[model samples]
Target: MLKLLALCLLTSLMYVQIAEAGIRYYKWEVKYEYKSPDCYKKLAITINGRTPGPTILAQKGDTVIVEVKNSLMLENLAIHWHGIRQIGSPWGDGTEGVTQCPIFPGDSFKYEFKVDN
Candidate 1:
């Protein structure tokens, strides 16, 4: 019994450490709003959930993982990391419909990229 418990504890700790490796997270808020019948609010167009979204802080060479969660009902959204010189990494540039489509309501899209100095 003691050996089994020890093994379980060890395994759990290892799992947590492994999960923390090479993973960075960025969160964004999406408003369920509409201006027209087809057009929905965009990331760069919105400010930190307002008009311009928040500017995320990350170090060069760090792996960035952006998780965009949509709360609105509209479908097809996209976010772009404008002016981020990523050495031709397309995932970091959050361009909707170009790199990856926007996440729908209650949906999430994980955008991962490594920063370069």
Candidate 2:
């Protein structure tokens, strides 16, 4: 009986560990605006009106959800997740005119995918 109880406990611990595998979530809002990074003043497309867009930091096995908003007046926008191998999720690849359509001006799109290494 004692051996059976020990085995059950071990099984329960293993199940818990599997259930608690590293899983994370992130959200971002992307926009376009004009900005000048250097001394020269010029109009440049940016995220959230900033020169440099927000950086996303997540561990392996984490899931990210980014909501891109195209606030440009006369330009269509699309976000690309470069270097991210979106396994099992090809729709979130963000390839303009390829995986998805261009997000029209004043429109928004959500990108959901997992960061599996």
Candidate 3:
């Protein structure tokens, strides 16, 4: 029993180490919202109902996975990485209608890419 307990503890430690080394994930929900960003109220595309959305904080050589859910009732949604260059994954280069099509309303799409320096 003691030996088994030690093995389990060691396995949990290794798992924690691997998880902290790399592999970051973010979940976002895209929807239309009306709010004042510049002191005026207008319809805007937001992630998780926030204007700017969530920011991804990761280091080079780390893997990032962002699962975006489109909640708009009448519009389609797509996300672009903007400036972050992908090293190996070219399909996720952030092109509209190219990265496996746009995420339709009430649908979910996962965008995964590796951070490159």
Candidate 4:
């Protein structure tokens, strides 16, 4: 009986550890100072610094913090978390001229928002 009880306690602790795991790091790079062939005008742009960003395992009520580092020549960048509710989370939405301005080149910004039900 003692052994069974000990096993159950260990299992419970492991489950909790898995559930509270932090968010995975995702890296991205936005490029500027380039004109499109058709447009012939330099504008804002984005490219995955590391191809295929890692898939983050997130759950409801989990606080997500996406650390973005801009290394462009000219122009700032921000991430707009789509499909996620931003009722009180304007920073994470990453809406230029709305929620928050883009981060300048060589600058870093940490977007924090909680996923709630």
Q: What is the TM-score of each candidate against the true structure?
A: 0.54, 0.73, 0.74, 0.59
Name the candidate that leads on TM-score.
3
Model 4, 1-117: lDDT tens digits are 999999999999999976875564555555544446466654535455322344556777577777777878766777777778886777668888787888988998887776665
**Candidate 3 lDDT tens digits, 1-117:** 999999999999999866765889999998888989889999998988897888889877688999989999998777878888866776666576775477889999888888776
Clashes of each: 14, 0, 0, 0
What lDDT would each prediction earn against the true structure?
A: 0.65, 0.75, 0.83, 0.70
Candidate 2 accuracy as TM-score: 0.73
lDDT of 2 by residue, 7-101 (tens): 99999999976675454544444554455677677777777656678787775667777777777788877788888888877877888889878
**Model 1 lDDT vs. the true structure?**
0.65
After superposing candidate 2 on the true structure, give the runs of residues whose Cα lies further than 4 Å from its correct spot.
1-32
lDDT of 3 at 67: 90
Q: After superposition, how far is residue 82 of candidate 2 from its true place, in Å?
A: 1.1
Give the clash total for candidate 1.
Answer: 14
lDDT of 1 by residue, 17-117 (tens): 65654546777767643233237543333423554466666666567777777766665567766666656567546666666566767787777777665
Mind sharing the TM-score for model 4? 0.59
Which lDDT value does model 2 have at 10? Answer: 100
If the candidates were sorted by their TM-score against the true structure, best first, what order would they fall in?
3, 2, 4, 1
Which parts of model 4 are misplaced by more than 4 Å?
1-48, 51-54
Winner on lDDT (1 vs 3): 3
State the number of backbone clashes in model 4.
Answer: 0
